[model samples]
Target: MSQPSVYPSVSPGDPSWWFSDALRAEGGEKPSPSLSGQITVDVAIVGGGFTGLWTALALRERAPQLSIALIEASLCGSGASGKNGGKVHGYWASLAGMAANIGADGALAVARAGTRAQDAIRAFATVPGRDVWWRESGNVRVSAAPAQDAKIQLYVETAKRLGVPDTAQALTPEQVADYCRSPVFRGGLYLPEGANVHPARLARALRKAAIEAGVGIYENTPMTGLTPGSPNRIATAAGEIIAREVVLATNIELAKRPEVSRHVSVFSSYALMTAPAPEKLAAIGWNRDQGLADLRMFVHYFRKTVDGRILMGSGSGPISFAGNTKNPALTTDRASAARAEKGLRRLLPGFADVPVEKVWGGGIDVSSDRLPFFRTVAGTRIHYGAGYSGHGVNPTYMGGQCLASLVLGVKDEWSTLPLCTRDVPKLPPEPFRAVGGRLVRWGIIGCEEAEERGVQAGVMMRGAAAIPKVFGLRIGTR
Candidate 1:
């Protein structure tokens, strides 16, 4: 008998409403068979989420003769890919951070690449039978608090300074009301390159497409052991895969690797989905397919579904200590879920009475600098990509491009892109990282809450919020 797969210990409420609804709409889809016995192939991709699935599809497109097999711990989409709030956009919103890390030219290259990846996503989402609910009405970042207005200014000014004035538009109070009449929204910035999707549906569609392309995928087949060499050996509960190359697209699992662990940490984010309230959304003039978020360090990101429901998410969930991937604070933190519900009441007050049908939470692999990176392991064919922070919906597509080029030994633009070799700042290690991270989280929450309430934060809180910048890091505050 095969040993049981070891799944992540998330909340009972997870796999989320997204996955549940996507499964119903999947139309006679049967679970993929788990791997059995020993096998060898050209490549063995681990994770089976967006990155792995996209890599498989990319590999097939680039080299039809190359054999590929992917293994997943749970269902293909059951990871963070399925458990997110489904906001999609490119790197223009992050131009300031990118430019600050890389140069202006480097930032532009990555942002343009993100746009191409986003275009691909839009095209894939709208194929004849692929009903991924691709809504492309753009995104809004509202200034719910007086202090938060600066972030909106920063995004707009950064884009303009980079000669991409069309990337973002600063909105006046009256202009903001045109999107939605939220009392909390003083003003906002509009970015044209934004969209939303039924996340699980999109992931499932990708899984289907990969299978159609003849990429072997095994669900509920977690890799139990991985020994890297020229021919990488991937041991699993039921079988083993020997492949010439391997792609470690396993999200937060990458945090356990010494090389990766130094540069990344896991932070939880929770979301609340309200029942179908199309009329209430219309009453608030939020009927468009726009995704909206507040300009807080830990933002309140919310959006509407094609079926007229609303999703309100809070990125203020707890952080895990080093190598403690199973922290319940990431998956079952009641305080974080409550904050999301509270945000829905505050931001979209028109839907204050709407019933929240579900509450789900998951972890985000946050980099020292909050951007994703891709590269190969030293002296091995094992390539990896991660640290997408919280804004991964579109970057994962770019990651697929980078990982694919790395595996093919091709030095094209996708492979040579700055993202592949950018020097990501290293995070503080061990006791200091965990202990100081908690203090910073407390400060961020306290500061943002005080600002929302039109008050001043304590000196200690403000100091804590400013601590990361002292060390050339980007967390604790925007």
Candidate 2:
């Protein structure tokens, strides 16, 4: 296949440009090219988004003299890292689900590491020229229906058992209305550790800090192939890099390469930002700033931007092969924005008239279990971390640190996290993969709808609704 134009350009230059705008506004020392052609480095990191940049930064801090090279297929932050909902909340995926695969101790270790990761991000924000609109106010997960409220309760109870300090507290219906202005919400959980940041700005700042610390970064450099031997060589469009260790931080983009395609699946997520909602911000008391997410299977996540706009996101529908490979597309279909707007209006009715100023979409790597995949590729010195399952912002920061520690042979707190050697089962082939994705999405939709109707919705009901249509099985419910 011919190489595609992955370079990020600003307005009038590229159709996908919101992330580039955010980066330019943050101001950073532009990364210099990797001009010294055939160079040797202690570590060579592919994919210059959050994972790659964070890994490079952490490695430099640990061993400043270790040579490192970071390469980006496009500009840094061009992936989901830049285009996500900007809610740096705690991991929303079920810890119990992860524990089922990795033991309870393993799950707790990951959660504790996430806490540390959030702290690391905040610490990074404090450095001069690296500030990126970090907001420390916590995140509130609202429950849109009564059945969903049950799950939120279970989540709170589980958090306490896991020794999570300040376990999410339940809000009374009145309290929910007072805080969220959403009468539709029965109750919700308030988590104190969650925070939000401008992801694009943060990614660029990380890249700048890494470069200043002597890490070489090359933009518009795609790793086409790799030869994994004693001193692994990574071949790119323009040149090749030889390094003692390699870190694959490509995430969803990993599917483009045959080496990782079997290990992950790419899913598209779409988001929209409204023109500044000053009046609405004042009405909801969100002027203090807190991110918000809901309890539905296809959840809605929203946050108050420093610029006074409400950034809301949803829609993770399966896309066709062509759609998946093409540039990001902004669509008014599926009524996602309207659905998001309705949810937002429930939270702050004052913004019912606020017009959406921008809409963008990006891809996330999702494993079958919905937990992150962190492991070394077999037969290679390459270490990889991907499949964050739509929770990458904070986790990626911590994951990067962990990856760096592993690469540098430092056994620290990050190094002890369950991520280092976890193995995710390989996904089935393309047609099956696509079919399974649609089935899962459909099942989720059915369950959500049934729950809204006050019906008891179970996993069996979800499976029954979708299995025959997509999976070609009856698989009678247990």
Top of the candidates by TM-score: 1
Task: List pairs with backbone clashes in candidate 2.
Answer: none
> How close to the true structure is residue 300 of candidate 1, measured as C-alpha lDDT?
93
Q: Model 2 off-target regions past 4 Å?
A: 1-18, 24-31, 34-36, 256-259, 319-349, 410-412, 449-478
Task: Evaluate model 2: give its TM-score.
Answer: 0.86
Clashes of 2: 0
lDDT of 1 by residue, 263-366 (tens): 88899899878889889988989868899998887989999999899998999999899957788788898788888888888888787667778888888999
lDDT of candidate 2?
0.70
lDDT scores of the candidates, listed in order? 0.88, 0.70
lDDT of 2 by residue, 297-393 (tens): 6777888777788877775444434225443332323344445555555544566677666665566666655667566667777888877878888
Q: Give residue 411's error in model 2 in angstroms.
A: 4.5
The residue pairs in collision within model 1 are none
